[model samples]
Target: MAPEPTSPVAGEQQDRSGETQDPATYEITKPLDEESPLLSPTRDEEQEGLIEDGSVHHDRDETSETKPLWYMILLTISIGGLQLAWAVELSNGSPYLLSLGLSKSLMALVWIAGPLTGTIVQPYVGILSDNCRSSWGKRTPFMIAGSAATIISLLALAWVREIVGGFLGLCGVDRESEGVKVTIIVVAVLFVYVLDVAINTVQAGIRAFILDCCPSHQQEAANSMASRVLGVGNIIGYVAGNIDLPKHLWFFGNTQFKVLCVIASLALGSTVALSIGTVRERDASLEGPPPKGRGGLIAFFKQVFKSIRRLPPQTRKVCEVQFFAWVGFFPQLFYSSSYIGDIYVQPFLEANPNMTPEEIDKLYEKATRVGTFALLIYAITSLATNVFLPFLIAPSYDSPANASLRAQRGQHTRLSRFLDHLVIPWLTLRRAWLIAHLIFATCMFSTLFVRSVGGATALIGIVGVSWALTLWAPFAIISAEISKLEEVRRLRASSPDDNNNNNTTDQAGIVLGIHNMSVSSPQIFATVGSSIIFKFLQKPRGTPGDHSIAVVLAAGGLSTLVAAFLTSRIQDEVEIPEGVVVEEGLAAFGVLSS
Candidate 1:
């Protein structure tokens, strides 16, 4: 073990070559406060210090098996802030678009950018981050750039008409013409595309960053924490979304869209600042290490193919799970607001048969608020599960060598006997996901029957269990497989006689990028599919949204069950189950034949 630095001052240890010591001696050092910048690294400084790629840092070799509690806090806060900002637009943007006097077709057209950006931007960003050897660190620069672009696009989204008006005037176009309005909408769509790309960039960077920084064993825990923070962020964002932002905020702007965005900007910006202070970034080049690989844009496409050919079948299942899971989830997520809004839309229209257009707008806003509240319920339930699930999953053994933990009352008792075929963790990914899919499927199926806000809230809230699983489980399984692959590499490297001209390269960023494609693909499919379905099912414009939304949601429910089935086929990377809660889980057969 290396000795601790002897200096109380800002002195770093030097080797024979007069270079600062390696990561083996100190993981990272951060400046603590603004007055003493050396004592406290800013988020930028933290990123500037990230270790380069190639060598894996074994958590077992460290003094602690995991990052400090404060590091976790910083991670959750920063990432959570990102989720919240991102969620605000997601949860409320549809209603905002409707309010902008857009038809269903126009809104769908605008949404094309969402899936396109997810599909294109995320993977490419991952490749760039993987090969990047910048002094500012691989991931942070991208994240910072994304954040700036996203914020700018969001502001432009809020005020596109005004901004485009100036441009139109410069081009000698009449501001009052319909053509000018069409141009504004086009400009707005462009901004939305940019916004989607920007958000994707940051998301890809952060997801890879987590994997890069954390060791193998902690991947599940880190992912779960991220999921929890995501819930918290969504909750914060949803709450903000629910607020009845007045058409005019004298100090901020004249439109609710503009005002709410300014609010989101402040909230997102502050959390990012906090994250910057606490988390450390890596720069592997500091050691004057062997020159790194550079593939540029072409490298990304090559990495995609390499990942496809090289990844194990077990690792590949993460994509399958994600693809099907999100296929089920996207319809539910994208249409929830409209679905719930439609319920009120019909009732309001009937009661005030002669209601003015302005009054109709008011009623629609109320529907949106109701939908936003349901979204809030979903977020809270997700948070509750995220916070408590670790304990629920912790094995309770009758003895050290017991095969199964004692089944808690709900997990193993009478309920277990009934739904054990489709319920909670008896072990690794297979059983755990089976339960998640069943529960979520049940919730999705129930959406068809929901007639009121209260029922919808309860149903959606319960689905958070599966939502939590979706966030963490696949990553956990994939990371475990990756750890195994890394061990294989280490073994080959150590074997004197196992000489092979080529060895496997563990490019975590590339792997994660491919996995992200699995997620984004479903969103695209669901978006297009939903657009088609809603056109046929929806009531004509000027009458609420769509009331028979349950039909749309039922598809999602069925898809989740399919995902559950797919999960059953996946091979377990870790132990199946440490302990059996129900004695029935162990079937005893008669004699040798049994």
Candidate 2:
């Protein structure tokens, strides 16, 4: 049987030629009221209206499905390698200059550069991917290209270090001198930063891909799958780093590291393959073909500004929270290792002044292993919280199918409602999760006050506990929110006469770009700020200086708390009608476009 139209939209509509047309036109600009993400149009305009029409039993067709468990594991392992490498770089590179004997001042420059690039790179790439049109498809091309670029960049970085050493050997420069090695190190670090941007661009694209392919109800599983894969990557990368491959293998030096990078590359490639192979997808027929206009660099910037200006208020609020959230997240991700190294390794070295170089290296290795152990715990906790916790929280545990059915009907009362009999308490719990996330940020800020190796290690280790909670809760909440937003948009678009005006994918990508900025911006601030405190300010020159580093970390943590409060406003924003006036006063300096 043919699907009926949502309204009388199919009977008489004009074509692009401006004549009374035969086919229904898809205009997507309608405001979605009380929308839900689980709902999607079956086809283009005609199919969309059919789903919207009450004539058919649309709810039967709108039910959610889950990806197989094995597929989730496989996909996670393939993708996790890159994150492992990322963790290594973040942890090791934070104190990279110190390891290379560069003065703290010079090392600061490298740290400052890492997150600065992220601030500029991730959002634009995310937005572009949303609008891209090609034979290969939107995201795959970016994924393939980004993976290839990341591989080349990593190889260049490893080789660059070797080249510097060889050059110093030829020039008769003191092999161990700070300047000779520092220059070489800085160059390599810069290259790594550039490559990292490319890799993250691919990562952001992959994230958007999740939002694109997975329907609203499946977002939790999708996000869980992503987190699991990240854990797999971390395990592989850390295990590889822990092993002294160079001592036993022929290519243990630069070659061994190169091989590991290659493994990461392959792993990232595998993620692309799995996504392409396993997930069903559809083209955004609404965007039409890619436009013919080719803008110059200046024109591109102009377009970016224009795009930013036109974003709706709810979209803008998401961006604001992200901006604040990333300000905390990035620094922690990129600098945690370095912070650990500085606080623990450097202090131990000073205490045992006569310790051999090999001993110092050994101690550093031990600390790293400890950190990795903490990370493993964190990953397990994240998986448990995100993957398993939701399953238990539904209306009741009669059977999985019945529970899911109850959730869909919104008739089944869950634990929160049963206990409190009020929505406010449940909402407060959600608010508290964000508050805890901010409090965790404060723990990061407290690092500036830490002076002893034990203190630093203990704090960093405890961080895993809070981290598990934050990652699980926020991700679960955000996934649900996005689903709600998508549903609302789809419903509005379902209006029989509504023109497909607002670019759904593009708008979504823009919001995600802003969201990722929360992840990226903090890296920029943390690296640059820490560099100033550790290097230029010369605070860590002694015990007193070490305390200064802790202070900086504490400030960042406090900022996280503030962000948690701000996240509450976003919850309210989510309930507002789409394209409506976003509540004012919450607006930041940037003007929000309608």
Candidate 3:
């Protein structure tokens, strides 16, 4: 017979009934000391896999402190690769589609594939990875498979026209035929869908891997490293988007989009391979097979619904804020480049009224590159914000008691002391998030008055501050709440008189998945809404002054205003004992860490 599963701590063992013995029941060989680390409430909480730094520790073979700094860096670099691909897509996808003769309205519909796939693929992959029992480990196999798919789909998307043309030629179809054009567009759309699905799978697996590998104490550091790497990737991606790649690197591809795809594929494949090769994952098969029947699609959705219903008040409020925030973010994320490009092209269109179609197309491409430069500015500002914002805002775990302890210990450097003096004590994470929402709303609305490329660039660059906070704050809030929920579940489990037996489900994966749903579901609404606006409000094709994209941006601003109000309503403060002090570590957003 198989041996009973053992708990991480030495004196804790699973009973025959599969329940952990109460801590009170465990025999003590030595007299307990009041100041003993084992007896401390903070230590108890850490043992329960909940860290105050907002890093969720699930199951892992080693502590992050035991791992070398280089190892942590390598492990987290894959997320940067993921962000690079995403940045490239967000910066150039719409322009590439327009180049292929797709209408602006239809282009919005095509973009819906991202949120649609994210809604289904991310959660399903999260659940699936959780239950995986492969020799290569639960997360490794999925990351490898997802990375391969992403590389393949990205290449296919980049070369879609060539692929479709080759197939049409083989079938003796005329290249100039309307049918041929429609077929090429259809293939490109399908490839975009596949690419989005593959990327989502990789993203979900990478995040789970980080949580599973990092120990309780170092969760914050690991996450911070990942975030910084992601920021680097964003910077590189936007910079590349701004450059004239065809002029500088003709060997990579004929067009800028194709070259970016090749670069992203190489970056993703190499980073994933490096991490997979260097990291020795624990064999999950040793954990025993996943619970039977829970792997099915119907069961998955049922669990999701159950999780949604059981979300904690704090988590539910965070989700509400995220929903509206994403509604505000979607238009800027997908359309800012196009919006700025349209503005840049307006004057040129008037100056060259009798320009040829090819000349007009060239002008649009040039204007899009300028817009891409603006996004580059946005990326740079966001990276700077991610680096400096942590010191300016108080951590979620910080309290006056902990502050006094840090001060007594002489741990504050001169810079930190100055920052502390400068920081308003009332500027908590929730309030900063609220401020970010307000900034985003104001910037989005500012587009209504922007007529020059410079003004648009300035507005977008300012939005970076909000973007950085958006990337960090919600996840931090939700993570703390989830950790609290996990503690409650553990407390109930250890209670002898507690009769509830259905608390076996892992709260981290389920709640995080639900949070992801909140972020993604709004994108679907935003895309559909933008499409309708484009259909009705956009000027005719080849018109000189189309402000439909601006209109969508303003709508997003309105949604962000709602998010700001909801953010103000979220309760973030909780009382902590005077002696307990959890160290402040780096915090970052979920997917794009830095």
Candidate 4:
């Protein structure tokens, strides 16, 4: 529903000296407490028709502070650097498990734990941060804690096997005993569990911080920068994972896993420190009355549920769009390497039916490398797209000098503005999905007849366009829309008896939580579904003439086609009727404008 029409906008303000001050020249030296971290005290044209229609006229102050571009750049690099380390942790997981003789099924359980922990933990953390009034700011403490956990988990993961072995020897158990094997299994699972929880915390903290601090207009830029960084991280991680570490200072002569874990610790720890240190926030608290919700864990879950119930229409729609989007994506992320590797090796297996298990493992390793190389190409393509596309595709805007012109024009309002923003980006996102899905579909089916490293690389690189959008766009849309409501709430806050606006802003954490719910819900399915297909359908490594790997890949391609269809059908923006401004004055809002 469209928000209630507001009273006429007040012009000019009364000065402390009993003079009438021009609205354009007004300054807000003091902050608006309980307002958004992203909201500037001064009003601008962009805020005028935020929904592309009428809204409460904000304080007419032009003296607003702006964040520097370098701040955003440093934030992205730090996150990207952390991703580089985190991705190494991810890429190394399966290999580390195999080295310890853990089964493929155990590896599947490990992967499933990530999405599970993410779905459960991130929302609670987001809610906690929203109401937190710590001196360092809401998000920084979480980021620091999560990073600390990541470092500890990595070091623990690296040395736990040896630590257990030494403990067993101390207890008079033989080093060659089965009890030692059970100890490795126990420690590995526990460490992986901690690592998963910690990583999710880091991602949630950083993401919320970005939304809290970045201006609505610049959100697309920030998200795209992060996406680009994610791509870079993937490349770095894969390369690092592939290296054979020389037997040096690895814990108890650790394998490649030790090298990766140490690198993960240093890279993630330093980057997280740098990121939290670089950005200064509104000094530790929002300068307003605390939100109206009852405090504590019960209120926390209640608020999350209530917020999910009351999400603005567009946020819900985006979640639906993403339900389909990730259905195709997570599968590819989980299984593309193994699927493609099996396909590439099918012919050799057909010719050498009786190959030894060692020889077969060698062949599969070579195939896996091909898959990794293709992923590198995908990462590079996504990076290039993320860096360059937004500016190239962005709309012409009113300059700072003409801050009020857009609002004054009255051409678009309310739902129209929402729709305008939605339509273009919606179309762009769907088009990317369509093109990428087509490419994916083509590659998947094509593999049945002929498989080549070049073909696999090309296919993934093409899909990277959609992948980049997936990483950036939904959050972009959610932030952009909710920020408008925030603008409405901020103005209303200045008006006594306007409790509804406060309620709207209270929805922030829950809405973001539901958005994550949508993200993880699909992963749960993909993890289970992909695991079934990979384990049951695909042939065991080194065995035999053929397997269902190509068939499974082709099925995922078809799923993407369906995902594209779902995306294309969404109506991207809200609808707002043209509003009639009845009057303008202090009494218009039952209170005087500043």
**Number of the top lDDT candidate:** 3
Q: Clash number for model 1?
A: 20
Instruction: Work out how many backbone clashes candidate 2 has.
Output: 37
Q: Each candidate: what lDDT?
A: 0.63, 0.52, 0.72, 0.60
Kindly indicate the candidate among 1 and 2 with the higher TM-score: 1
- The regions of model 1 sitting more than 4 angstroms off are 1-64, 169-176, 246-250, 287-299, 395-430, 483-501, 575-594
> If the candidates were sorted by their lDDT against the true structure, best first, what order would they fall in?
3, 1, 4, 2
- The TM-score leader among the candidates is 3
What's the true lDDT of residue 13 in model 2? 41
Every model's TM-score = 0.77, 0.72, 0.84, 0.77
- Kindly list the per-residue Cα lDDT of model 2 for residues 556-588, writing each as its tens digit: 676666667777775432222222221121122
Candidate 4 matches the true fold with a TM-score of 0.77
lDDT of 3 at 574: 56
Per residue, candidate 4 scores C-alpha lDDT tens digits across 1-594 of 222344333344455566775443443222221111111122231322111112121123211123466766766665776676566554556645655666555566667777788777888887777667776777788888888898788778878777888888888988778879877877888888898888878777888777656654455556666787787877776766555453554553356667767776777777777777776544435335456667777887786776766566557767777765666666566555665565677779889889887887667656766666666677777777666555333222222222233345553466545533433322343355455555656666665665665676677667667677777767767776665455445555543444543344443455576688777777777677666765776444466544454555566666667766766665443212112121221122222232
Cα lDDT of model 3 by residue, 40-90, tens digit:
111222332322222223232243233456876887888989888998889
Backbone clashes counted, model 3: 2
